[model samples]
Target: MLFRLSVIIVVMIALVLSSTWSVNVQAQGGDEPEECVEFIQQVLTDLGTNCAGGDPFQGCASHPVITLDIDEEETDAYTDDYLGLWPIAEDALEPEERAELDPRDRFPLLPAAQVDASRFDLANEEWGIAKLKVSLPHYPVAADQVEDTVFLAVGARIEDTTTPSDAYFPAAPIDISTTAETALREAPRANADVLDTAPSGVALAVDGISPDGEWARVLFTTNRLGIWDLAWVPTSVLDPTVDTSDLPEVEQDSRVPWQEIFLHDGYEESDECSLAPPSLLLLIGPDEDTAVEFWTNELYVKVRGATLFMIPPSGNVLMAYVAAGVLLVDPDTTDEWVIPAGFWGYWCLSEPDFYGGRVPPEPDEERERVIVPCADGAEFVRRLPDDDMQAWLAALLNPLGEEVPDIVETSGIGGPTIDLSFNNSDAIDPVRDACELGQLPPDICDLYEFPS
Candidate 1:
């Protein structure tokens, strides 16, 4: 009886182990789409890494690396294919000269040719980078073929940040609508008349105007968002073209010049203050869906500029996608147009200094020389490699009575955990330090439970 009981007990233990092994295998098994796998492989290849160590699933690493893949064929289409459609004399056409054509006749239409799909290689590339693959429809062409302008529709797939093991493809193509010369002539009429008046709450200033009076640039400040917006439009539509004979005698009231339009924080003005060049300025925003819905039939065009479209702020996924598109087309100057640091705020048109009075409190001293903790629990000490220790100490000590938290450590919890420690202590007063603290806002400290 004892021997029989031992045999049964051993069999039950074996079964339990087998079941556990099966569960693990299933967990590691990747059910992701084959195309997604190909894309990830391609990105890894581009980054000069092998797929073995980099696979999101079956790998030991916690965070998957992000990678971008450009559709070279599509990129080439934008660069080479679309350029072919430009009228040889497009640059030479005067505003009036181009305006003579029918509005429908002036639209830039894409060529009817099909793009070769094979040129987009998402798989079999070198490894170790996360992958993204974008497929886009052929450029749109007009039925009449009289207009040789091109419109492109692009689609993209990116690895999901929330579910790092999976990927997502855009349901719709991002549309790039081209403007006609006639439409350009009609842009200025849509401006708000109050734009000319500098009201108490909203400040408006005109910037550059096109020589033909077809376009005008303007800047406005919004109190709510606490930022300035600069926009360009056709002038004929903004205000009735000022008759030269009846023009105002005041110098500042005269047509705004592009060079003088940019606002500077101080008296010192330099070339850096200049706006981006005309060709390079593609005004995109208010978002993709908004742009399409509004522009499709609305009498007034609210959003105009290169590729302006709305996208969700999470992971800044859309911004990264648009940035990639812009980069692929204009490789040399792509970095200059990277998305600004703060773009999620609602855009408002108002006057300068509307929210200028609400500037956040200045940092307190002693907070300066401290080593702060980063998201990863790593210490970040800002030391000038070229300067002597005494110089650094002097800078840190000069501004006394400001609290600066210099050390950062992890909270020892899972999932985006972080903790801040000052000078290796569990509690320290930031204001007691000699240098001013910049990053740790009051609200953030309160949430993190930093000592008061």
Candidate 2:
């Protein structure tokens, strides 16, 4: 009973001393208060280490191996101090243009040797290295800024303070994204100008991360001079294992005969057709049931059970079917057809064996043209210019053609997948003019929403 009373009295004495010491050093104007000094002495003594007299000036001083914050106030102060030290790029500077920029930005600048403040919590150990809660800046100023807070370690080495039992390592090749629409800003701060928005799954390359691991310096593509660039994003939205390290910073411009500017891959200008939107396309399915669907907003046109079509940019439709008659119908109502994968394979009129059809039993001596087997035996020829009519019909009605599937396995569906390289610009204009004049079938004209 006497020993227990003595223990309580000692604790009371220490509390009184601690309170007095805290008051004395409250206005000392140093980053660490005398209160922290007392806490450090207690921590070192508890660990069975003697700092001589427990005097910071006389004995060993705190070396700041890491940081720990006591409450909400210190966390905010730490976050502010860290941001002032954050890096920024010069105006109009491209991340790719800089020779100093490293391709991969690993999170937690230091991979290891960091510990959280909560590890130091005990009965009376309120002071230690401050582990601060921080939030990195995001683009477009997000509406809810509270969810971004993350715990980060800050510290100093002590004479004999206990080493953290738990150590954390930063994410290797850091990657991040926002849950909703978030902008990639020019600088790593909320007030910085917004460069552009990145949708979910638009993978970004990590270049660097803030000290607190809250903000990430990310690489992005832009429409400016150098094209590839860097921006800041909040670490909160980072997706796990989503690394884009191999993607090139500056996308190589694709060469086309028309546009000098670099276009994305899988696109090239045609020497035959006049300048038109790349959206103009043709699709051929791998099977006969697969349908051919055109796109220009509304289902512009659809052909079911048809292997081939002669499409001109003028919104006119001419098609040929194999083993069945062509069914031109409204885009939405068309069934028994899947979108064509590409134009070059299977349904290509130029390929001799792509379709099977009957040959004309007799030749047209007057036109000097012979009927050739095409479109699985059903031959329908549209009158084109006198010069192009024979060659065009011959290409369509490939008499020596072999059986081909409706759709090819390896075809792209968007836009015109077929690589039509015809040099006959004159023939295209006339057919387009005819279609514009409503000379085609009613259902075919209806695709363009032309007045019936």
Candidate 3:
């Protein structure tokens, strides 16, 4: 913010001190573009007084957006700052001047769409990477402050999130091969039931490594059902050339924990109302001695030089739209989980065990696990849905005053929210499991074919 302000200030100061300064400002043309010189002078002179009023926050808000015309003789001098569009000047002013001007009479800033295109780079272009920027300050430090105090972005939300139990990591699996034919254990231990023997050369996918680094949780087809499923194997049997150091650590029940970014579920807000951002991204810029954590969501992830997007806690899942650089996620008391820049990570809350096609845990011994481990877990796919994505992108890329796309309309009920729900079932793909699992509505589920 200061960088752009300094550039404009330098240009403004040079113009003011130069021989042409008086000719530009003293011109009696009130409505002419040259009058912008007068506007800038008034703004620069009053910046200190207006911004530093009794209540800085309220004081800054008192100054409304204003459009000032540049001196046509000097338009080329600072035209680039205007970006070929009218620049809305938001500077402090005297109480008398504030009451004289009707804010509505002034021109608006560049359309949010045009401005977003030039500024925001959500994880849209590449996979799993969005940058969360910051312009928030705890209090007013200077009167010449030109930074944005409203730290929220359009698609981001922040709310009071409770501290979740323990650390968790979603299943992030990739295909590999069994180094040698070995018996697949029902659990990571060698004495566990042998589900099957994986051939020495056959392909399999492993999602987790055991705490002791002695075993791995692998998913492969079994001879009985021939359906893709999960099993455990000794880590030594996995391809030695590949690295398992970064895979999520396995817990009991072959479950991968919901570790990274544990957020509260749903659009629910808390009565305490501390406002911990259920969705907004923050650039903490943490140092080695930094003390504050963003919110109480199990893990405290301090990232440097990378962007992470925390998704709205929906469908009982806490997700992060990943960024394109290597992000290190560290929990205070556990081994770190490394999410390669290309993959997204989330923590899904387990429901009553019956909901997940499994038996319930003992009341005193319940644990949080993914409902449908692989299906609900993240999968690396070759193709992403581009058409639907482009529709979402339209909101991100449209210029000011352009009609918004039919999708992603803001639902005004919750303060400035985006309606990301899918109303038309026509666009939904007929995932067979979604229909059989009762995830889709009956009418929509009936569109897909299922085996008798």
> How many backbone clashes does every candidate have?
52, 40, 18
lDDT of 2 by residue, 240-306 (tens): 4555343222111211111111101111122222111111112222122323233211112333322
Computed on alpha carbons, the lDDT of every model, listed in order, comes to 0.22, 0.28, 0.33
Model number with the top TM-score: 3
- State the lDDT of candidate 3 residue by residue for 224-314, as single tens digits: 1112345788878777888666676765532111112222223222222111112223232221111112321443443321223443323
Q: Which sections of candidate 1 miss by over 4 Å?
A: 1-215, 220-227, 231-409, 412-452
Task: Output the lDDT of residue 59, model 3.
Answer: 14
Q: Write the per-residue lDDT of candidate 1 for residues 108-206, one digit (tens) a residue.
A: 222211111111223332112111111111111122221110111111111111110111111121111222221221224554333323322222234
Please say which candidate is ahead in lDDT: 1 or 2: 2
What's the CA error at residue 163 for candidate 1, in Å? 34
Query: By descending lDDT, how would the candidates be arranged?
Result: 3, 2, 1
lDDT of 1: 0.22
Between 1 and 3, whose lDDT is larger? Answer: 3
